[model samples]
Target: MGKSTRNVKNSFITLSPSFFTHLLSVSPFSTPNKNPSPNLSLLFFLSLSILCTFSGICLLTFYPISRNSIPCSALSPSSPLSPFLLASLSSVLKDYSPNTRNYDEPDLSSSAMVPLPARGVAANPNISAEGRDFWKQPDDEGYRPCLDFSLGYRKASSRISKEKRKFLVVVVSGGLNQQRNQIIDAVVIARILEAALVVPVLQVNRIWGDESEFSDIFDLEHFKKTLQADVRIVSSLPSTHLVSKQSIENQIPYHVSPMWIRARFLHQLNEEGVLILKGLDSRLSKNLPLDLQKLRCKVAFHALRFASPIQDIGNRIAQRMWIEGPYIAVHLRLEKDVWVRTGCLTGLGDDYDRIIANERDSNPDFLTDKLNIAKSARRLAGLCPLTALEVARVLKGLGAPSNSRIYIAGGEPFGGKQAMQALMDEFPNIETKETLAREGELTPYMKRCSVLAAIDYIVSLSSDVFVPSHGGNMGRAMQGHRAYVGHRKYVKPNKRMMLPLLEDESVSEEEFRSGIKKLHKYSKGQPVLRNNKLDRDVLAYPVPECMCKR
Candidate 1:
């Protein structure tokens, strides 16, 4: 974790008056008691004074540094830049020292220990120094350092031996309110990488940012430490503009937050790699050109994990909403967590409006302009009208009882308490809760359930089947083995063609067409999704007997 050194400060022999005389025995000039020529005497005294000062400075600077210890000044709160200086001085001393300890001693016990700098890729010897200096940045007045009071020194000095130079897995969340599946996807990927996890604790602009959506599955305090270790940084909202208002920025204790800041920071993030599975449905996937498909794959494998859903949550929640004997988890997603917009309006303006328009189209009633249309369509298309009717139709076709209790868990499409009420109205027999009180724990209802993780699972398991609503990231995550459906032609085009609309406020039909030509071309036939099912290799667990029963 630190450089090794042999020169202990207390063990060094001090140069006393007797020692200075002894040193003169080995030098060209002998020590004189007094000089006769005044000019010559003055020049000799000046040279001696300069030599003593230089020697003292060199000895003092290198002594403690040679011991491979962070300097005392670096540990003090007042010294902001001393940590970097101390590390630099230690490196210099290590280079010049005669007796250096070999950290590379070959031992079977040290196999788990992090390796020293080998041939090409150098171990970051300065990570500790950088971390220490990061801690030294001014803490806000009212803000006590959230880090351990002893500072990051202890954790910074200790190295957890791993087989490779590990990378971190950061999850950039849109917000806590929406994108629970994306959060789950982030968690699944973290497990895959065997890396620590963190979320950007954010202030709410749209939904309650503090809402603990995935608390049932993960730990928060442990999450915070992961961020401190630079293993992960999950943000609720990604700001394109890096400028932070002075007052807001000053609140940061270590002056660190959501912004990883630049491409280099992203490049340096090897210890934590993200599997950002976005919500691209098969319908959209079919319409995308091979290049766009390649782009999606590149982002999935290369940059981060990009994924989309084969079915919407509205549909999934409906099919799996079992409130009685069989309790099921029905998670409804109301917002897009990862902003997938191409250009300017990706997060703002009229371009933003179109994005919202496309999202709202999941509700047929939303297409019809009622506030409850999204909710109505959500219920009708999912379970109550469509699924219920489909259940009756299936029962007629198969001859089984059509009586079963279902549970639905979700927020309103229009957003908040009012929307929940509309959903409750759709199915009076089913149990529904606007907000479950289970904080950081799974509810009792979810535990009792031998559940359908999604509608695709339900449809594959039971006789009731309906086409899924919109492209969903959660659905893709749940497709363990069952076949999936996508609306390639029905769903709108990829987000790339939408970029020009952001660049121009008023886009004409011809201009839009011309711009669309810039998009990577796709197979022009029926635009149906191909290979919509999950690749068997990607499942986290074996496909259970219940899932494959059909």
Candidate 2:
């Protein structure tokens, strides 16, 4: 070693003849120290620091200034800017960050754990019919022009005094959904007729074997108060009132018929002072006047809110789903009943046909619709519910990322593990009510099918993206609700295109993605949703009644 510089411990640091002078110029001990320059000592340390930095070693440079040096000891080297530098470096090395203080770990825990649906339960036909539109006609998809609801709510010419009694009775014979719709029809008709509606009698459908009454589920008092101004409502008929399975008289006057004539004629015919309107038929969704349609919106969206308890559970689950991030609620409705009735399996082998035949034989009453429907017509009308496997393929192909948190909202998805096997790989986290709530909590809702469906319906209304697998009662209801709550993203599947596309396994991943992208492009916004058909009711978020946009 040269006399000017020497090695310390086992390592040596070299400095050129002029390095000592340069090191002193930049060193904290710039002023001459009482103990001398200590130039060689500072030079060795500075060189060591430079060498260690290039080798990826983050050496702590803030060791206190040397005691023997005056200027070095006078100044403290620590500064506020050093933390910023440390944070930047720590961000690059997040996985290996020394502590959590440097960063806020993203709160994805709730979304990471989705409420799981109870799979493999065959007894639960009580499942929500989320994505099934059982009522679409061939012309259901025809063009729908924009409506000017701004002026749609003009006062009707027939607003008679509430003191007049236009007493009416209705028979609710269908299951939950069909009857729910029928009630809306009845209320709208009663309002039209300026009638005092008797609390409707819910007949026990022998097929279901349940004897639940309307008061068992619906808030009867709320229903009365909600429609109070429009129509006077009572819960039951007097002993003198006659009951009939069929309409007591056929010609109920429509809006085009003079209201005065309807009031006078109906009162004249029913000498008993009450019109017993039987057979649940829908008039609210038909070609009604603008004022009535707006009124229907009011009844459906505003007045028909579920009891707070059902809404509470649904909101809690929804909040959990959204806590980590927003998620999609996929209306998965490929139950056994939907499968056989739709005849969507026509082209598949006899195994499917035999399976369908067996179901039909076991339950002759299951296939309610007697229409001679062709598979093509069913395809065009989107009658068929997609199987779980088909859904998985569609979702994967749609470019939904693996991290997507989806809730499967419906009854037991058909085919179980075999069907969901593909979807599990694509979306590892899929949950349901069984996963979210305890069995004890759901027991009360078991017999209340419509309320159970309403729970799912409420969750769906608050979803980031609602993908209905079949066009069913619950699906349509929530789709309408979503529109009312600012049209948050409702994706109506074009089953005509999706079914055929999924069976082709020959397609590459790129091709699959592109196909899904094109298919879903239609469902992203207001075009399909805005174009409300004569039958379907989601018109660009509820125009005048549900949403005022203020």
Candidate 3:
């Protein structure tokens, strides 16, 4: 026997004698009997001995032990316990004992902890076949995009003299949407400083390795024309200021007031005549003056038009999607980088988890949540991205038919097609850019990530129903854009509310569907004003400030 098994047996053996003695001492039969007979005493002892033996046998049979510690082959065929009995006992022990593990059994601990459905399977097997009216457009709620900052807004050109005209050159970094945000903020910052804004430079994407310039993605002439009255946007800095340029190395703090901007940059800009700012992403304040915020809306919605080629292809894709009836655009942000950076579990099993964990370990700074929350707790708190299974369940619950055509935006998911298998299984009629476009359509922009993202953005903007699986730059941009155009059907998953219900195995299909419907009643592109008190992004929730009610 192994050391652990021997120790267990020895401990039980040592305790057995004392246990019997204590039992006998506490028994009423043990009380002194004056007329006790020898035969009766012998029979009583025999009965007690038989009972003790049976109890010991039962204890041994049910005793929890490491399955590897004791070999089943050790028991001889002639032993009192039959093979069937031994197998039954093993099975019982396996069910009850936490430590007893069968190597042959699949590891369910991860799934149990996560509470997500199996790969390529819906969360609820019995999905409702009844179709939902996803075609109905959401109520506009009397709101319309009104970028009317004209009343109190002064043009920067009229305010700043030509002699004191300082040039502001900004280098915007990050992904497509992030860069878009930075570009909007750059214009606002230039207006704040009363400086001529040079066309913001697009930082080379480190991951994508695409050296795409600003002109490559956005229409240069249209951008300049749209903001001609607000600020002077030039292709390059003036020759006089080129040699005297000052670069700001430190990052500007978030939510900085206009006064702070003037105080910090006005004198330096005047002296140098040219200021170069890098890493301008989220550097500008969220709660700028109404005019600046309006300016922001104008820049984001109107000024920043996609390049001709990208626009043409994007419009073509959007037209194609529209031709096939109303289609749902799903911004499935399941990229490996997203998983690593957000520290969100992919629910693709332990292998993917290990891959993410490995990447996270290597680049600790990439993790968005620095709180060091537990994975399960993070998932429960809705920090994790909705898995393919979860997305399928949410759609089904929201009344999307099995035959609903889905246009999946965003890049290739972590596990490629396999990651999207569940969603495809739930709704087979799905199309992505590659599948939708012709052979030579996307050839030129094949390696251009930003351009590709722009294509997706346009298609998403025109989609009948837009569903973002997680909150990110793209989702936020789309939310505001859809609202600005008209309240299109946008479904923001109630992850915090829906995750617990999804994890709950006890919730029936009907109950799950009802719960989902209830959770998302007010979430479907409802025209609610942005809560500025909460410091919500105006770009994401552009309602009262950027919109006017009819």
Candidate with maximal TM-score: 3
When summed lDDT is taken over every stretch of 10 residues in candidate 3, the lowest stretch is: 110-119
Question: What global local distance difference test value does model 1 have?
Answer: 0.28
Per-residue error (Å), model 1, residue 442: 14
Q: What are the per-residue Cα lDDT tens digits for candidate 1 across 307-415?
A: 1121232233333342122222233333232221211112224654466557645433323223443333433333211122222222122211223233342223323
Q: State the lDDT of candidate 3 residue by residue for 1-550, as single tens digits.
A: 2333222244334334444555565444787567655576566677588668767766765654322221222211234443234322232123333444345322221111010010111333344434434445667775655544443353234464232468888888889999999899888888888888888988888777888999999988878766665777899876777674355645778677889888988899888778888877667777777777877877887778898898889978877877766578999989988898888788888998899999999988888865578888888787878888999999988888787788999988999888999999999999999888998999999999999999999888877788999888999999988876666778999899997789899999999999999998888887877764647788888888877664
Q: Model-by-model lDDT, in order?
A: 0.28, 0.54, 0.74
Candidate 1: segments with Cα more than 4 A from true spot: 1-171, 175-217, 221-324, 327-400, 413-428, 434-471, 474-550
Error of 2 at 434 (Å): 1.0
TM-score for model 2?
Answer: 0.63
Q: What tens-digit string does per-residue lDDT give for candidate 2 at 1-550?
A: 3566542221233334465556555566577555655465666588667656523322222222111111211112233433223213122122321321112222111101122221121233532222111101112121211122232122231153152445777777655656666677767667666667887777785644556677664666666655554566777655555445324644444323235435544664345567665564443345455555555554565455556677677768766676655467888876656776666663345775688778876876666443577766766566777766667767666555566678878766555555556667778888777677765877877766556666676666656677887776766666565554334456777777775566577977788767876887656534243325544453223443223321
- What's the TM-score of every candidate structure? 0.28, 0.63, 0.74
Which lDDT value does model 2 have at 311?
61
